[model samples]
Target: MSAVGPAEALILLVIWVVPAVVLFFLIYWAVRLAIRHEGRRVPSLHERVTAEREAQRREWAEREARRNTEAPDEL
Candidate 1:
């Protein structure tokens, strides 16, 4: 009910803010480490997606070429 003093307010701030800041850093570092680990194993997300799309394009092109060369009876 009464107004809190400066020392009490600081204590309360530390009790609340310290853990929050620590938690934020912990999550940030965890995500960074996970990304680094994945990057070591393969390319980044954008590069991987691009590479996959390119591969699919080439495969489709090859298939189309093969189909076009085949006789109508093969259809």
Candidate 2:
């Protein structure tokens, strides 16, 4: 049987080690986040929409005010 040469050994190391390290970190982060966000309450859809609409309204109001101030008044 042919023994693993240097190049084949490096390829084998890469194929095994990279994903194993990646998978370890993936699970680590998943658990960390799961613990971190365990009991946080997410905003409801209605609340999110209401906040977004209010922000949009304020932005539009500011934009309109700026426009009105910047434009020369028609005689």
Candidates' lDDT values, in order? Answer: 0.91, 0.93
The candidate that achieves the highest TM-score relative to the unseen native structure? 1
Residue 47 lDDT (model 2): 89
Query: What's the lDDT for residue 43 in model 2?
Result: 79
Looking at model 1, the pairs that clash are: none
Residue lDDT tens for model 2, 1-75: 999999999999899998899999999999989988865869789989999999999999999999989995799
**Residue 64 in candidate 2 has what lDDT?**
92
Sequence-dependent TM-score of model 1:
0.58
lDDT string for model 1 (24-74, tens) is 999999999999888788567998999999999999999988887884445
How high is the lDDT of residue 69 in model 2? 95
Query: Residue 63's C-alpha lDDT in candidate 2?
Result: 96
